[model samples]
Target: MDLLRYVAFTDDPSGGNPAGVVLDAEHLDEPTMQATAAEVGFSETAFVVPRGGGRLDVRYFSPLAEVPFCGHATIATAVAHAHRHGVGELLLNTLAGEIAVSTSASPDGTVGATLVSVPPRTEPLADGDLAELLAALRWSAADLDPELPPRVAYAGAWHPVVAAATRARLAELDYDYDALATLMQRHGWTTVDLVHRESPTLFHARNPFPPGGVVEDPATGAAAAALGGYLRELGLAPAVLTVHQGYDLGRPSTITVTIPQAPGTGIAVTGTAVPYES
Candidate 1:
């Protein structure tokens, strides 16, 4: 029943996205898990139920509600598992799908985890929905990137992939939290994946998860995996991708996304993690 805190996607605990990692939740119920997650007050708290057959049932809960999947929490959980059992592979049954997680130890004694996401799909943004979303964020059509269309992408969870034409535009993140949260709740979206592509392989990203009661997420590996799928689906990229996030928050974290052009193959997101002192 111990609650461990760890930050994923950065070797330094103070750098990456913080997540509550509970390695064993065998004796906990849904209510208790939710309360625990709320008490932890992270964007997401992962509860790992170690079942038989070398598989663990993973559930993610934010301070407000449950989510389909959470990448930072998954990375934190994998690192916690490695700290106890050693670096290796793990089978996780999440609300989204079956995720395969592999862990490796770095030279600096940091534990990293790579999780393959479910096959991704995208849908055109509804006209009305787009208007509402723009209003919620106070962003107009001119503020978007013509190269990256506004569409809803799904890897494990659904996210609106909105690309800013300029870095300055992405940095000025002022939005109505309640309005966005309402819209996201109605659409079942995990977050809005705000992105700015710097080059062919490098990119910057920010995730606004108002529905989860968070202003912005520093690092979002799941959203990066979904972005990789979206890019490949739209013929934006053919191979691997690198996502740089949290720079705006001053706690930069890197997420490497591996893309394969299979019909229904999962996307892999890799990042390093470390335990939090406080």
Candidate 2:
């Protein structure tokens, strides 16, 4: 099987989050997919099988296990398909649900993909859960942004959305990885969305993805979608928003989200992908 590597959310290969894409995995079993993901060593790898009628069945596997959905991997797969089949709209059936993705070629010869996530939802974080999460991160209640509050949000996957009051608080990411991993495992959380608001339409984020065997994700499309949902549900939605991520680790990525007026609708996450030599 040929594994195609791509970095999503940036035009430069050295900038975005890298993901492995298997364009065709019709004959591959679950074990093979899991093993391949581990070997690839990216946070997640997408296995795609053509289902005809411009539809593809996609499965995402992390280094440690399978995940319901992955934004960066989906972006990579869509861009790869566009390269082979031409830029257009495609329907993807993921473990989470159906996602619609559209790809286009830019004037600069770059391919970009925008994925509409499954209908997202959010639930208030229980006090006990919040306490545990805070303890794991070594953060006190004072560190949180009261404006954003805290909640568990879901688009394709679950993420605890925590907003830091200051950029400095968000940047100091020392945390108990194992403890947080265990907590996330129990709650079925894919990542901890640690964010700081730079402006009404601009945000900076860091994602702790111990569940995927990655200490941190350079750019997280799934979490970005969840954040959009969280904002809309809380009546803080913006017409358009930009998420800036990966600067701390040097692989900067940019994700743009567009939220519709209708409630419980899919959140659109757009990003560019570049081929990686790996």
Candidate 3:
């Protein structure tokens, strides 16, 4: 099996989240896939088994366990497929649901991919859960932004949307790993989507991914989609919004989230990717 490495959400190899891609994993079993992902040691690794007719069965595995879906790995896989097979549309069968991905190239020859998530939904964060979450993150209730209330959002995976009132609060991310992991595991949360709205059309984000056995994720596609859904559902989203993430991690990445006017629809996330030698 050929293991490919690529960074999603940025054209530069050193500026985005790295993912492992196995484009042809037709014979690998679950144990092998899990071991491979663990060995790869990125946030997630994508294993694809072609089903023909532009359809593929895709599985995402992190170092510790398998996940329903992964945004950055999906982008990396799509871009890798485009480089090898050609840019077009693909129907991905994931554990979460069927995801539609499209690949295109820019004038400067950068390959980009856009994945439309499954219909997103949100649930109010229970008061008890909120207290536990804040305690784990070492954040106080007063640090939260009133405009963007806390919610558990789901696009393909579940994420708790926690909005910081100020950028400074968002930057200070020293959370208790074990406590947060336990809380997230109990709630079945994929990540804690910590965000700060810079403007109507721009935002800053940081994701705590203890569930994935990682301290944080630089550019989280799944959480971004969930956040878009949360904003749209709350009537706070613009038609187009830009998310700046990974700045504090020093691997700055950009994610573009597009919210359709119609309610109860999928959200679109677009970003460029590049192959990296690993």
Candidate 4:
């Protein structure tokens, strides 16, 4: 079981969110995968099992349990694959849906990966659920950004979309981890997408992943992709947007999202990943 450490959304290994990626995970069982993720101690570790015809079955595991999908880990896995096999397209069959990823090189020859997420949908949060979520996070209705109302958004996994009125409110992530985790577990939510709009195209984000045994995810590609869909569905932003995250955590990373304002089409999330060596 070789665990490769990589950081997605940044060219530098020290930046972005660190993830454990197993390029070939054929023999590992469920318990073994969980244990490996726990030992790796990252937010999420991706296991890729090769199927026939250039298709791969991908599973994501955190220290605590299996997550339906994870963006950073996907980016790390694709970057790792690009290093071994030349840049190209790969079909990933995830628990959530089928994801199509393409790898390319920048002008400076930096490998970057862009994943097209499954079609997204958003629904207004139920009254009871929103109350419970606010109580768990210790945030009142006043703290939320009025422009981006609370909604349950889904790209691959379900995430309760909450927007902060200010960047400081988003940065000061003081939440009851256990309480939030219990609430999320009950509601089947992957993460609380806490975001603040710096501008129409530029935004800041923080994701609380207590269920995954992580305080905050530095760079969250999943949430970014979901946000793009959320915005498109709500007519919030233009088709293209850039999200900056992990700055408050001191691991600044960037995720670019492209939405074509089309219905029943997946949004694209683009980022770069680099290998983290000892």
Per-candidate alpha-carbon RMSD to the true structure: 1.1, 0.8, 0.8, 1.2
- lDDT for each residue of candidate 3 in 1-278, tens digit (9 for 90 to 100): 99999999999888889999999999999999999999998999999999998899999999988999999999999999999999999999999999999999999999999999999999999999999999999999999999889999999999999999999999999999999999999989998999999999999999998888989998999999998999999999999999999999988899999999788899999999998644
* Model 3 deviation from native, Cα RMSD in Å: 0.8
What overall lDDT, based on C-alpha atoms, would model 4 receive against the true structure? 0.89
Angstrom error at residue 24, model 2: 1.1
- TM-score of every candidate relative to the true structure: 0.97, 0.99, 0.99, 0.97
* Deviating ranges (above 4 Å) for candidate 1: none
User: What TM-score number comes out for model 3?
Assistant: 0.99
Per-prediction count of colliding residue pairs? 0, 0, 0, 0
Q: lDDT per residue, candidate 4, 74-149, as tens digits?
A: 9999888888877999999999889999999888878999999999888889989999988888888999989888
Give candidate 4 misplaced runs (Cα > 4 Å): none
Q: Which residue ranges in model 2 land beyond 4 Å of their true spot?
A: none
lDDT of 4 at 69: 92
For candidate 3, the lDDT comes to 0.95
Best candidate, lDDT: 2
What lDDT does candidate 3 reach at residue 25?
A: 99
Candidate 1 per-residue lDDT, tens place, 1-278, comes to: 98899999998867989999888899899999999988999899999999865589999999999999999999999999899888989999999999999999978788899999988888998989998998888899999999999999999999999998988988998998999999999999999999998887888998999988899999998899889988988888758888989998988899999998885789999998888755
